[model samples]
Each structure stands twice: as C-alpha cells, then as structure tokens.
Target: MTTLTVFYIGLFYIAAIIFFGGLAYRIYEYSRTPAPLNIPTTPAPTTAGGVVVRMAREVVLFESLFKSNKWIWVFGWLFHVGMAVVLLRHFRYFQEPVWFWVEFIQPYGKYASFAMVAGLAGLWARRFMVDRVRYISTPSDHLMLALLLGIALSGMMMTFVAHTDIVALKAFALGLLTFDWHPLPADPVLLAHLTLVAVLMIIFPVSKLLHAPGIFFSPSRNQVDNPRDRRHIAPWAQALERDNA
Candidate 1:
C-alpha cells in the first residue's frame, strides 16, 4: 500500500472509532445525569385544539426558525436538501457496475452540488453581513461552513469543469470497502473534496450538527402536550420505580 493510502485509512479508522465512542459516552453520561424538571408554572393551553395548532406550527412550519431569522430557515432547508442529494449520489462509489438510479440522479447531483455551494456561501455571507449573526457566530461555525463550501465547490469542479478518472475513484472506494488497499491515482481536486467530506464526518457528531438527532429528543416535539389529568406515566417507568422501591 502507498503511504497516502495507509495514512488515509488510518485517519478513517481513528476518526470513526473516536467519533462514535465519544458520542456513545456522551449519550451515556447524559442519560445518567439528573435534570430538574421545571414543569411550567405558566398556564397550559386551555384547549386541545389550541395545543395541536401550536405544536403543528412549531414542528412542521419551523415557527422557531422563522421567528428567529428567515434567512436561517432558507439556508437551513437548502443545506439539508443539498446534503441529502449529494450523499445519495455518492452511492456510485460503493456500487459495482454503477447503479441505474445513480445514473439517473447524476444530473440532480450536479444541481445539488450547486445548491450546496450557494447555500453555504449565503450562510457564511449572512454570518458576516448580518449584525446579529456576526455577533453570535463562532469560529467553529465559520470553519464548518467554509469546509462544506470547499467540498461542494470542489465536487462541482470535478463534475462540470475538471474531469477526473472516476474509474480510479471507484477502485479506491471499493478497495477501502474490501480491505484491499489500492493507490488509485485521483485528481488533487477529488482529493480535496474527499478530504473535506472526511473532515465533516469526523467533526459532525461532536458539533452543533448533532441537532439532527437532537430534534427527535426535543421535549417540545417528542413529548405530547396533553393535560396531566388525561395522560398516564408509561408502564416501564412505573415498573422501574417498583423495582427500585
């Protein structure tokens, strides 16, 4: 194996283990930690219809994001759609005899890359140009956006402008999957794109990007807002209490 291959493989394993292990440990610690439940002293929504409307507005319409900043909502939606499309397109790397669906989506992948770059640029621009965003944005936020933009832009260049030998790209990916390391000659542009993607994956679980998973855990979204008189505690929690007693 070439030094480059070895280095990249080592980086991949190290990143995967550390990122996953740390995430697991963090979740374990969070589960063990006791949180004070400040059940709202504020008056609850008087009617079921009102509660349903409010919940629908918050969860479905992203009322919080709209209330905070319309640009945030716009950029956020674009970023997510672009990322999803790009990721799906990457299935070409893994599948031998490139899948028909991948072929079909190739054009969409180009558009997705464009959208991702545009969204990232807009977001970064907002961070600088908007007074509130500038005040609140951290260096990490800027770095993440920059990295994503770099990856998307490089990918776009590879697709539309600077063509790389994608056969070599497939070989390299398959080699990685099969544990048969091959030094496939890839374009520097491709290397930059892959490296940025790797960096994003490594940083993702640790960063605010974790809000992807956090939304499911959100009390407001996941917890049903019914009157305490109407709902009963889960049998599992009651059983656990009985066992403890």
Candidate 2:
C-alpha cells in the first residue's frame, strides 16, 4: 500500500474509534443522569405509550421545533431528511450486494444533495440574519455548519462535476469493514469529502450535534405528566427513602 493509502486507513481507523467510543460513553452518561422532576412540557404525553408516539413525532417531524418556529423547522427538517437519505444511499458502498431499497434510492439521494445544501445555507444565514439567534450563536455553531456544508459541497462536486473512481471508493469502504485494506482514491474532491466526514464523526460526541441523542434523555420531552397521579421520585431519592425507612 502507498503511504497515502496507509495514512487514510489509519486516519479512518482512529476516527471511527473516537466517534463510536466517545458517543457510547456520552450516551451512557446521559442514561445515568438523574431527572429529578416530572417536567414534561405542557400538552405532553401522560402515558408511556403516548410518550413513545410523542418522541417519534419529535424525532421524525421535529414537532417541538415545528411548533416553536416554522421557518427553522422547515430548514432543519429538510437538512435532516436529506442527510438521512444520503447516508442510506452510502450503504451501497459498504455492502457487497446492496439492499433493494438502497439500490432504489440512488436517484433521490443523488439529488438530495441540493436540498441538504440549501437547508444548510438557510440555517447558516439565519445565524447572521436573526438578531436573537445571532446573539446566542457561538463560533463552534458556525464551524459545525461550515464543516457540514464543506462535506456536502465536496460530495456534490464529486458526483456532478469531477467524478472520481467510485468503484475504487466502494472497494475502500468495504475493505474498512473487513480489515482487508484497499487503496483509497486520491481525488482531491473525494479526499476533501472523506476528511470532512471523518472530522464530523470525531467531533460529533462533543459537539452540539449530540442533541440527536440527548433529546431522548430530556426530562421535558421524555417524562410523563403524572406528578400528581403518582409521586415522581428519582432513583436516588428512592434509595434515600429506603435508607430512612
């Protein structure tokens, strides 16, 4: 293997490890954190089943975001859905025989890049255009958007402009899965795309992007509105009560 191939291979391995390991650790921390109050938002679910449905709506439809701000929700939903389709499309590169649905979405995913970029651009613009949003926005927030925009733009360039050797790229992706090394395509666009993806993965656990998982642990979202029906005792509180008894 050439030095370039070795460098990319090592870079990806390190990136994958950091991404998965850090995310897992962060999720574990989230699970262990205490929710001491029944703080579900108004008009929230009262039962576990209702909570599930509510969470589904929040996750898939961005229900809370939709209710809070329609414009932001529109852009956020477009970016999320488009990014999901693009990710699903990438399964073809890793699987030897891609699933039927994955094969079918190729055309949609090819064009979804446009939606992704447009949504990102709108969201980024909001940081500058909206006074309240701009006041609260940090440099890291802007950097994250820039990183995602870079990844999406580079990928579109590879797909619609300067095409790379996708076959070799697929081989490289599969090889990463099986420990069998393959030479990574050294196309500048491809390299830029992959590097940005790796960077995103590595920083995801520490970044604001962690809201993806953190939402599930949110007391305001996940809790049932039943503090009056049944006492809302945290696990630690329960243990203290037991010791007192």
TM-score leader: 2
Q: Candidate 1 local accuracy as lDDT?
A: 0.73
How does each model score on TM-score? 0.78, 0.96
Which lDDT value does model 2 have at 67? 81
The most accurate candidate by lDDT is 2
lDDT at 28 for candidate 1? Answer: 71
Off by over 4 Å in 2: 242-245
Candidate 2, 1-245: lDDT as tens digits: 88989999989999999999999999999998888778898788889999999999999999889989988998999999999999888989999889999999999999998889989999999999999999999999999999999999999998899899999999999999999999998898899899999999999888898998999999888988888898877899999989999
User: For each candidate, C-alpha RMSD in Å?
Assistant: 4.9, 1.3
lDDT digits (tens) for residues 94-147 of candidate 1: 888888998899779778877777778888999999998899999998998888
Q: Which ten residues in a row have the lowest lDDT in candidate 2?
A: 33-42
Count the clashes in each prediction.
0, 0
